[model samples]
Structure formats: structure tokens, C-alpha cells
Target chain A: MELSGIAAYLVSFFTFVGIYAILALGLNMQWGFTGQFNIGVAGFFAVGAYTSAILTVPESPWHVGGFGHPFLVGIAGAMVASALLGLLIGWITARLRTDYLAIATIGIAETLRLIIANESWLTNGVRGMSGIDRPFAGVFQTLGLTSAMGTLIVVTTFLVAVYFLVERARQSPWGRVLRAIRENEPAAEAAGKDIGRFRLQAFVAGSAIMGLGGALYAHYFGFLSPEAFMPLYGTFLVWVMLIAGGSGNNKGALLGAVVIWSIWSGSEFFMSAALPDAWSGQSGPLRVILIGVLLQVILISRPQGLLPERAPKTVPFGKVANRKERA
Target chain B: MDLLIDLIQLSIYGIVLGSILTLGAIGVSMIFGILRFAHFAHGDLMTIGAYVGLSFLVFTGAPVWWALPAGMVGAALTALLVDQAVYKHIRRTQPVILLISSFGMALVLRSVVQLVWGPNVYSYTGGIQRPWWFGDIAIVPNHVWILLAAVLIVAALHLFLTRTRMGKAMRAMSDNMDLALVTGIPAERVILITWILGGMLAAGAGVLLGMDSRLTPTMGWNILLPVFAAAILGGIGRPYGAIAGGMIIGLAMEISTLYLEPSYKPAVAFVIMVAVLIVRPQGIFKGTL
Candidate 1:
């Protein structure tokens, strides 16, 4: 590939990075902030994608002529639907032990995939739905910009906004409570926190963000399939990103998404390009092996990840007063 | 009369399936009981065991009976090696870390198997002639053998657990690891023994399952969920509870298929597990880690 082609590939890669970053931020809030291990993120993502696709697909019983609604509205719908589903699932499984919770969430994710696969009317079944409209296509056409460029622009903007919001949330009192819950659920409970409610709140809110990311992904890809939302893809990648990047830090999440996604895409590209024809068929299995080895290395070497969460520095009241007086 | 026979036949199949599940679940439950965490790799371990049996069958060209013992021995050794290599180092880490490590191990095992065996289904038994039966229903010889094996395994396990010194030590360690260690029960040896036994049983189950149906790389993936469900339903650490739970889950799953789509069979066990967890979080057997 030429330099421009490589650059274009980079653009597509970073677009995925931005989208997954948003999703990982949500997961960080749930797992890192609130200590709720949700393995069913792909389910919520699928729900969001299917919701937006079904609502906006032309000639559907659920709605008419795609409603010609703005892409932003579809994103909003995805978030809302995902949040509702999250609330239901979180309420049911939140109180279970960590391992059981993981199992339950995995089950829910698999079940969601199965439903999407079997329900032909809603998701077009295994055939999948296509022809999703890209946002700002008209503006891009007028500017003579490529659709990928337009998508990159919109997705980056959304990601930035999401990052800002998550950062603000991290600094807020609500964020403190979530951290408290993560650190010691019993302590939080003794401190008059409604553990279940707070967990549900965090889970639902984070899942909504994941849903929004899914909606963005659907529009960019112009297609939605049950296969696109496999548990391995959704759960494992999110985990890799969160763990590889510092879990609690939004910046780490973003960096992790970009870095890990690049490794993944680059490896696949190199394997296909460099390997002999006979060995080419083995690439997929090789990729899985690579990821497994990488995960083991990460787990053994740095459980806290590359850019681990930093403890907040405590400032003395006397120092604050002295500084204020000087100012 | 015909309906009664069909029900009996269904129950028999369910019991056989339950036996396989019980064996697998016991391995998982024992690991969880001693290790204080769920090992997601147990299902894949079952797959490993099945593959071991298949390899034995192919290499020695042994009868199915001879292959069974060889497979069990292979499985026991593999479990010991896996423990020494991957699990022993990280056993002291946080439960979640160990759990995640198990996932990595599962992936490695599954991938290695796929690379070696390819993704296609393999038959462990070269076609057995079906035994002719009385009445409207004809019971396959393999099914009867599976059920008999399950009963014998369970009986042997019960006696071994109750009668043997090593088995007593395992129980003591499971009940209280630190206490068992302090009492000079050699907790490490006990754990090794547990893994060996668990591995043997899991391998036996896998071989039986392969005999009943085709063995594929993903064979264990489908069974993993139900086995976990059975383990949880039976109570995490209790062997007898796992057996009972397996039977219930197997019956529920198979019988439910009569009413619902076959694809939904896996979900039945999951639903039952969740419901049991919600109702009695400690599981039906009332043990806690």
C-alpha cells in the first residue's frame, strides 16, 4: 500500500480506536470505578445497533421509511435503549459474586446474539442489515471530502466530548462513591451508600455510552450482523484495552484502545501479506494465539497495566491556606 | 404405554447426559472449592481429556475399554502438568486474576488443540453396532455403557472419598485449607490428588460424550456452561450436590427441548442456574468458600 493508502488505513483504524475508546471508558466506569465485572458489553452494543438499525431501516414494521431521522437521534436512541436494558440486567445480576456475575453477563451476551441471529424480522437474521446512512454525508459531499474523513471527524468529535464528560465525572463526588464501592463494598454500605442502586446507576450509564459507540460503529460500517458482536470481540477486546491502558484513567483507556487496536490490525495485515499461501489459512488461529500470549505477559508482568491509576495526592489544609494567602 | 416408554427413554438419556455433566462439574466444583475461584477452563479441560482419549484410541488401536483407562491416565497427567505450569504460580493472586489466567489457559489449550487436530469433528469410537432391544424403544449399547460407567464412577468416587486416606485429606483441605495444612495433612499433595481425580473423571466423561456424539474442538464450549450451572446448582464444592445438580440440569435441559427449540437447550441450564443462585445464593447444598 502507498503512503496515502496507509494513511487512509490509519484513519479507519483510529476511527475504530475512537469508538472503542468510548466503549472502554464506559466499561472502566463500571469495572474500575464500581467493581462490577460486566462481560455482556457486546450484548448492549448489539442491542443499540439493532435498535438504531431496526428503527431507521427503510420499509420496516417497527417504523416507516427510516424516519429520515438525523444520525444523532439514532445515537441517542441507542444509548437510551441500551441503558434500559442495562438497568434490567444489572438489577438482576449485580448482587451475585464476581465469578457468577461474569458467567451471567456472558450468558446474556450469548443469548442476545442468538436472538439477533434467529429473529429474522427484527435484525434480518443472519443475513444482516445494510445501507446505513453516514452522518454529515451531504456536508462532506459539498466539501469534496471522503466519507471516511467525514466519519473520522464526527467520531473523533464525539469521542473527545465523551472523554471530557468521563473526566468530569471522575472528579465528581459521584465518582468518589463509585471508587469507594470498588475498593470496599462493605465499607461503602456501612457509610450509608445504597450499593445496589449505585452499581446499577454506574452500569446503566456506562452501558449507554457503549450503546452510543455501537450506533456510531453501525453508521460507519454501513452494516450490522450478529457475528459483528461476538463475545470474544466485545468482552475480550474491552478487557484488553482497559487492562492494557490504566483502567481508571480515561486517557489510558483512549490510548489503550488506539495502541492495542493498531497491534491487532497491523498483525493481521502483516500476517496476510507476508505469510506463504499455504500458511495463510492459519492466520486467524495465529492471531488468537498472539492475543493469548500477550494477555499472559500483561497479566504476569503488570497486573496494574502500563499507565496504572494514580492515587490522588492529599493536600494539607495549612498548605492550602498558606498558598491562598500568598495568592 | 408408548408415551410412558418415550418418557423413560428420555429420562435415561437425561441421566446419561447428567452423568457426563456431573463428572465435569465435580472437577470444576473441586477446583472452585479448593482454589476459591471458578475455573472457566474446566470445560476445555474436558475437551483436552476427550482429545487425549481419541489420541490413545488412534495410537494403540485399542478397544474402547482399554482406551478409557489410558485416556484417564493421560488426563490426570495433563492436569498435573497444567497445575504446575500455569495455575500453581498464580494461585495466590486475587481470584479474578486467577480466573482471567484460566481464560488465557483455555484459549491456549483450545488453540493448540485446533492447530494439532484441526477444527473438524473426530470420532473416538469406530462405529459400534447398535444393540437390538425389546419393545418399541431400542437402547444403544453405548448409552447403557455410559450410564453404567457414570454409576460405577460415582460409586467408586464415594468409596474412595470415604475410605481412602488421601481422599480424607482432600476433604479436610477442602473444608479448611489452612487448618488442614496446620494439622500436617500435606495440603499440596491433597490438592494434586484432587486435580488428578478430577482430571480422570472429566476425561472419562469426555470419552463417553464423544462415544455418544461427535467430538469437535468446540464440543466442550457448549457443555462448559451447563457444567458450571450444575456445579453452582449443586453447591460449589460438594461432590454429591454436583451429581444431583447435574441430573436436575440434564433433565431440565433435555426435557425442555421437547417444548422449545433445540437451539434453546443451553439457555435452559443457564436460566436454572440463575434462578437457583437468586433463590439460594449458597447453592442448594449450602456450602460457602
Candidate 2:
């Protein structure tokens, strides 16, 4: 490939990686930190994308997109919308087991997808929203770099900020409480922790981040559709990222995001190159199977993940001393 | 009288749908009750079964009823293989991890189906047969076959569980694994039997439902929530509860169309499932949590 071609690929790859990184981070916070299994990641992501798209896009006759606001404002609106949805779902389903949450979230996500598809007045039904504004299109054109590269840089920088923010939260006392509840819910309850409240907080916060990822995605692509936020795209893809990278570790989440996404997007290229024309249609299923097998292998072999959650370095002095005595 | 006829027609349709749900739900509930975790791949297993039946119809030119048993066998073998290859190894992990693993299995199964079936919608037979009139209500042959198959399977399962030695042993293990083990009930044998029964029933449901509607790779996945709802609504681990839950969900979904858009039929089932989960997590029939 030529240098320009290479740059294009890299930029597109990094942009997708950044988008998924944010999403995986959100999920890591929920399932990793708080032990909340949110199977409805797609729902929050869709809410974020559509909310922003509807808020910022110019008015259309068929749909509700008259706000025509600034890009950042739309992004904020997406986050708020997703956060509110998360809060409602979390509050309603907080007391149940992870199994219950899994079903509820899937139901919510699928229902949302249906609504977006059927409720044409709001979402334009199947056609989806277009002409979503990117944040720095003018700057990219001025620099003579492809617009994709500009979005890539912006999205990557945003991803780094999100990573740092999540990392900071992980080290906080609230984070410790979340870990405590995850390790042992009964014990956490006994220690006077309001388990439900903490779970709700994590769920909402995680959902907000996922929504932000959706906004970035919509702005970058300049289009929004319910089909883009299918469970396969939104939920399973992120789950694979977290599980492979090592849940509960922000850096691992990032690494997994880049590696797995490359494999996923890269597989199609490899398959098309390797296979004959007649067999090319089988490539999608082949790649899906590859990922599924990878997931099973990961779960069976390294349930803790590639980079397992790090053991805390600083221990309670008393406990350390007692352990030394025993040794 | 005209309204009554419409109501009767709807009820028949509901029952037909309910029987399919019940068969699928029974498999799911049994897996949870016996094996102690939700089987996410159950829906796809149903799809696999339906596809296997379709294959029989295509290649052998077998009658639709003849395809049912062959499909059930294929699905059963797939379940056994899947259990040996996947679920057996991860049996010791956290239930949540097992759940995730099942999701992977679902992916694998779905992709395999897509690969083999090429993602096209196919019918068992191309032509639509006219429905027979019962007084003023119309009943299709496919619906009758579905209802008949479901009743036969359920009755057979009931007799097997109540009368057969191995079935009773399976029940003992489900009731209390530790005590059953102490009493020398072979755990492996029971587990095998559970998978076979679950597989057979799921396949039966799949084929019959496929007969009623066009078969697609996602037919089972589409109805996944309703099946799960039926299982949970009836009581997750109770076979009879699944049957009752299926009937209720099928009726509710159909009846909901009176007040809701037909497109939102599945949503009605979901709403019912969530409501039941909130009001009674153990299920309406007091299932074990």
C-alpha cells in the first residue's frame, strides 16, 4: 500500500479502536469494578448516538432533528440521555442477580432497537440520520490530512482522557467500596455499604461513558442508525475486549481494544485475500466463529484475563506484619 | 358470534405458539434446575434442530413429521458435543462466567448455522395449505401437528420422570445433588439424560415452530427472550411451570396485539418477564432461586 493508503488504514483503525476503547472502559467499570453485568451496553450506546444526532442535526421533515446545536452540546446530551436510562434500568433491576440483569438489559436493548426502527417520526425508521458534524473537519482539511485522521486524533485523545478518569476513580475510596461489594456482597452489606446504591452509581457512570463513545462514533461517521448499535456491535464486542484485555485494568482494556479490533477488522482483509471469490461470502461467519472460539478459549484458560487484575501493592500494616509472622 | 370466532382463532394461534415456547422453556428450565446455570446457547440449539429438520426435508424428501425425530436426534447430538467440548470444562467457574461462556457458545452456534445455511429464509414446504374450519374458527394442519407433537412429548416426559428408574434418579439429583450422590445415584448418567431430554424437546419445538413459520438462522434467537420469559415466568427449574408459563406468555403476546402494534408482540412478553422478575424473582410457581 502507498503511504497515503497506509495512513488512511491506520487512522481508520485507530478511530475505531478509540471508540471501542471508551466503550470497553465503560463496561470494565460496570462488570469489573462493581460486578454489575450490564448486557444492555448497546442500548446506552444507541441512546447516546441518537440523542446527540437528533440534538445537533438540522431539521428534517420525517424526523425530530431540529435542534441544530453545536457538536459538543450534542455529545453532552447523549451522555445525559444514556445516564438517565442507565439510572432507571439500574434502579429497577439492581436487587436482582447478574442473570436477571442480563435478561433485563438484553430486553431493553432489543426493545430500544425496535423502537428506533419502528418509530419513524423520531428516528426516521430504517433510513437513519445523516450529516452528523465531526468536531474538527475544517482543521483536517486545512492540514491536508484526511478527515478520518483528524477524527482519529481527536477520538484517541478523548479516549486517553477517559482512561485516566476511570483510573483515577478506580483508586478512590468509592472504587474500593465497589471492589469490596464485588468480592463479597454479603460482607459489604454487613460492613454498612449500600450495595444497591453503589451498583446504580457504577451502572449509570459506565453507561454515560458508553454513550459518549456512541457520540464520537456518530460524529465521526456522519451517520446514525439503529442497525449500527446491534448487540453484536455494542455488547458482545466490548465484552470480548474486557475479557481478553483483563477486566478491572484500564490499561489492559486499552490494549485489548487495539489488539482485538485489529484482529476483527483485519480478519476480513485477510479472508478476502486468502479465499476464492465463491467462498468469500463465508468470511463474516468465519471471523465470528474465530472470535467466539477465542472467547471460549480465554474463558477456559485464563478466566482472570491476559493481564489479570493487579494485586494491590500497599497492604494494611497490621495484616502485613501478621502475614510475616506466619511466614 | 363473529367476535367469538375471532377470539377462538386467536386462542388457537396462542396455544400453538405456547406449545413451541413450552418445549423450548422446558429444556431451559431443566438445564438450570439440573446443571445449575442458564444455557444461552439453548436458543441456537433450537435453531440448529430446525435447520437439521429442513435438511432432512430437502435431501431425503421426508415428510415434515418424519423430519421431527431426525432433527431432534441431530440437536441432541450437538448438545452432547457442545457439553463435552465447552460447558463441561467450565463447570467449576462462577455462574456469571458460565453465563458468558454460554454467550460464546451462542455466537459459535449462530455463525455455524449461518455458514451452513447461508442466512436465507426457507420454508419446509413452499405452498400454503388452507385451514380447516371448526364451527366458525379456522385451524391450520401445521398448528394441529404442532399441538399434537407438543402434547405427546410432554406426556412422554411426564411418564418418564414419574415412572422410569433413570428418570427418578435424575429427579433425585436435581432435588438434592449432595444427598443423591451419597445415595449412589450416578451423577454422570443423570447429567447425560438431562442433556438428551433437553436437546430432544428443544429440537421438537424448533422443527414444529419452523413448520408454522418460515425458517431462518435467527428464528430461535428472535424468540429467545420469550422462551426465557416463559421459563422464568413458570418457575425456572420446574418442567410443568415452564408449560404453564409458555401458555400464559403466548396468550399475553397475542392478546397484547389488541392494544399494541403487532410489531411489539415480543415486547409484551419482555414486559411481563420483567414485571414478574420484580414482583416475584423466584417465579410465580415458587421456583428455587
Candidate 3:
């Protein structure tokens, strides 16, 4: 590959990693920080992506689109839309067993996918929505930055912002309460922390971050489709990333995203190059099996993850900040 | 008159579907009761059963009904294998970890099915069976066989639970783990039995579901939520309650076509599950052991 080609490839790859990293961090807040198991990451992702696509895209007869808002507005709209979905799911499943959230989330995701496919006027059905221009097309053109470069920059900005925000949340007393709930729920409840409320808050916050990732994805790809947000891509991959990188740690979430995505996308190239032409269709599932087995191996061999969560040095609600918090 | 006929017709269809859901939900209920985790891979287990049955049907060239036992055996062995290979290793960990692992297992099973079956739709028989007419109401021959098989299975299950010592032991374990352990119940044996039972019934459900509809790689996964709704509505851990839940969900989804779009069938199940969760969180049976 040429130098520019390699750079462009790297840019697109990192852009995807940045988006997935956002999702992983969001999940880290829920599962890693609070021990809420969510299997419906795709639902919130699709909602955010469709919300942004419909909001920012130009008028279209195929679907509901007339606003043609700015990219920031679309991204913000995506966040709000996904956050509301998060709130509904979190509220309903918070007081129940941890598994209830898993089932409920998957249900909502499946139902949402069905609705997207069936509701033709809303999301253009299975035919999908296209022409979702990259963020700030005019400015990027003037700046002489490639579209991929511009998207990577935007995704990186969001990734960094989300990382900083979640890290801050992880250090706050609020995060401590969440961790307390995860470690020992009865203890946290006895301490006068409303367990249900804290869980809901963490869930909603994570969902909003997933939404932001979805919006960035919509703009970066310049297309929107229900298939784009399958549970495999939107939810399962995020879970694998967080678990592989380090669930409780924010930096681990980022590292997992980049590393796993490379493995994922890298496998695609490998399969295409290695497999015979006649067996092309089988490769998709073959790749999935490889990754699926990888997940099982990781779970069995090193459930603690590549970067196991570091114990917070400062005691819960302690006034003195631990110097290691900066790490 | 037409509306009554429509209702009755839909009810018949519902009964057939209810039979399938009942078989599937029983396994889910048992697994959740005994294992203390929602078996996310149960749906894919159903798929494996259906495809296994398909393979049997292809090999034996017998009536499709004969495929049932073959599917049951295949699924039971698969379940035993899966439990031993994957779930057993993580059994000591939190139930939530099992849940995550099962989710991965669901996808893995599905992908493996696709690789083996080639993702195209298949049916047991090439030509459709003529529907039996009962005063303008239509019923297929396969539906009758499915209903009869379900009845026999349920009856056998009831006897096994009430008569057999092992069955009673299984019930006792689901009811109270500590007490069962104190009573010297072999936890491992009971757990393995639960997997076998769950797998057999899941396959039974899968094969019946295939008869009711066409078989696709995602056929079982598609109905996963509805099966869950049936289990949850009946009470998550109670097998008997799952029966009632299955019938209700099946009828509700079918009859709903009277007013709602057919595509919203799964939504009907979701709405019912959510409503049950909100209104009667313990389920109608209170999810008792």
C-alpha cells in the first residue's frame, strides 16, 4: 500500500476504534463500575445512529428527514435519544436481578431492530438511509483534510472527552458508591445510598456514551442501516473489548477497543485473502466463531482482563485523594 | 360469526405455537431455577435441535415426526457437552458471568449453525400438507401431531416430577439450594440432569417450531424473547408456570394479528412480558421454587 493509502487506512481504522472505545467506556460504567449486565448495546446504538441520521440528513421522501441540522446538533440529539432509552431500561430493571437487565436489554434491542426494519417511513426499512455526509464537510474541505482524517479527528475528540469524563466519574464519590453497590449491594444500601437510583444513573450515563459513539459512526460512514447495528457489532464486540482490555479501568476500555478492533478487522482481511472464492460466504460465520471462541478463552483463562481494575487507594467517601488516582 | 371463526382459528394456531413455546419455556424455567441464570443460549440450543432434527429427517427418510427423538438426543448431548466444556468452568464465578458467557455462546452456536447449514431456509417436507377443515376452520396434520406430542411430553414430565425420586430431587434443588444440599442431594448430578432435560425439551420445542414454520439459522434466536416472555410470565424458575405463560403468550401473539400487524408478534410478547414485570414482578406464580 502507498504511504497515503496506509495513512488513510490507519485513519479509518482508528476512527472505528475510537467509536468502539466510546461504547466500551460506556459499558465499563455500567458493567465494570456498577456490575449491570447489558446485552442490548445494539438497541441504544441504533437509536442514536438513526436519530442523528434523520436529524442531520437533508430532506428525503423515503424517511423522516427535514431538519438537516448541524453535526453537533445531530450528535447531541443522538445522545438524548439514547439516554432516554437507557433511562427506561435502567428504571425497569434496576430493582430486579442483574440478569433481568440482560434479558430486558436484549429484548429492547431486538424489538427496536424489528421496528426499524418494519417502519419504512421512519428509517427507510431494510433498504437503509444513505448520504450522511461527514461532520463539517465544508470546513474539512477548506482545511484540506481528507474525509477520513476529519472523521478520525472528530471521533478522537469525542473519545478523549468521554474518557476524561468517565475517569472523573470513576474517581468521584458517586463512582465509589457504584463500586460499593457492585462489590456488595447490601452494604451500599445500608450506607443510605439508594441502590436503584445509583444503578439507573450509571446505566443512563453509559447509554448516552453509546449513543455518542453511534452518532459518530453514522457521520463517519455516511450511511445508516439496521444491519450496521447488529448485536454482534454494536453490543457483543463492545462487551468483548471491555472484558479483554480491562472492564473496571477506563484506559483499558480504550486499549481493548483498538486491539480487539484490529483483530476483528484484521481477521476480515485474513479471511478474504486466505479463503477460497467458492467458500466466501462461509467465512463470515467462520470469523465469528473464531472471535466467539476467543471470548470464551479470555473468560476462562483471564477473566481479570489484560488490565485488571486497580483497587482505589482512597477509601470510599474519604476526603484525602489517593495520588494513584492520576494513574 | 366471521370474527368468532377468526378468533377460534387464531386460537388453534395459538395452541400449536403454545405447545412449542411450552417445551422451550420449561427448559428455560428449569435452567433458571436450578442454575440461577437466564440461559441466553437456550434459543440457539433450540436451533441446534431443529437442524439436528432436519438432519435426522434427511437421513432416515421417515415421517417428520420421527425426527423428534433424534433432535432430542442431539440437543441433550450438545447441552451436556456445552455445560461440561464452557459453563462448567465458570460455574464457580458469579451468575452474571455465566450470563455473559451464554450470550457469547448464543452467537457462537448461531454462527456454527450458519456455517453448517449454509444460512438458507429449509423445511421438513417439500410440499405443504392439506389443512383439515372443521366447519370452515383449518388445521394442518402436522399441527395435530405437534399437539399430541406436546401433551405426551407434558404428561411424561408431570409423572417424572411427581413419581421419580430424581425428579423430586430436581424440584427440591430448584426450590431451595441450601436445603437440597443439606439433604445430601448430589448437586452435580442434578445440575447435569437439568441440562439434559433442558436440552431435550429445547430440541423438542425447536423441532416443533420448525414444523410450524420454516427452519432458518436464526429461527430459534428469533423467538428467543417470546420464549423468555413465556418463562418470565409463568415465573422465571417454575416449569409448571411456564406452561401457563407459554399458552398465554402464544394466544396473545396470534390473536393480536386481529388488530396489529403480524410483524409485531414478538412485540406482543415483549409488551406482555414488560407489563407482567411491572404489574406482577414475581410473575403470576410468584416464581416459587
Candidate with best lDDT: 3
Docking class of 3: medium
Model 2 misplaced stretches (Cα beyond 4 Å): A139-146, A315-327, B1-3
Share of native interface contacts recovered by each model? 0.41, 0.67, 0.63
Best by TM-score: 3
Q: Estimate each model's TM-score.
A: 0.92, 0.95, 0.97
Question: Which scores better on TM-score, 1 or 3?
Answer: 3
lDDT of 3 by residue, A1-327 (tens): 699898888898999999999999999999999999989999998999999999999998899998989999999999999999999988887778887788889999999998999999999999999989898777887999978788888899999899999999998989999999999999999999999999999999999999999999999998888898788998999999999998999988988998899999999999999999988888889988888888899999999889999966766543345545655
**With candidate 2 superimposed using the best TM-score fit, by how many Å does residue B283's alpha carbon deviate from the native?**
1.3
In the range B31-98, model 1's lDDT, one tens digit per residue, is: 88777777777777777888888888788888876656776897788788878876787677777777
Model 2 clash pairs?
none
lDDT of 2 at A6: 87
Docking class of 2: medium
The C-alpha stretches of model 1 lying farther than 4 A from their native spots are A60-69, A313-327, B1-6, B126-134
DockQ of 3: 0.71
* Residue range with the least summed lDDT across 10 consecutive positions in model 1 chain A: A60-69
Off by over 4 Å in 3: A315-327
lDDT of 2 by residue, B1-289 (tens): 7667766777888899999999999999888877877778888999999999889888998777877898899899999998888778888777788788888788788899999999899988889989998777788998998899999999999999999999888777777778899999987778888999999998998898898998888888888889989998998888889999999999888777667787787788899998998888778787754
Better of 1 and 3 by lDDT: 3
Give a tens-digit lDDT track for model 1, residues A1-327: 599898898788888998899889989888877777777789888888877766565675522245656787788899999999888778777777778777777777777887777767677778888878887889998999888889999999989888898888887878889999888889999999998888899989998988988888888888988889975677777778888897888788988898788887888989999999988877776777787777777877787787888755557889989999999
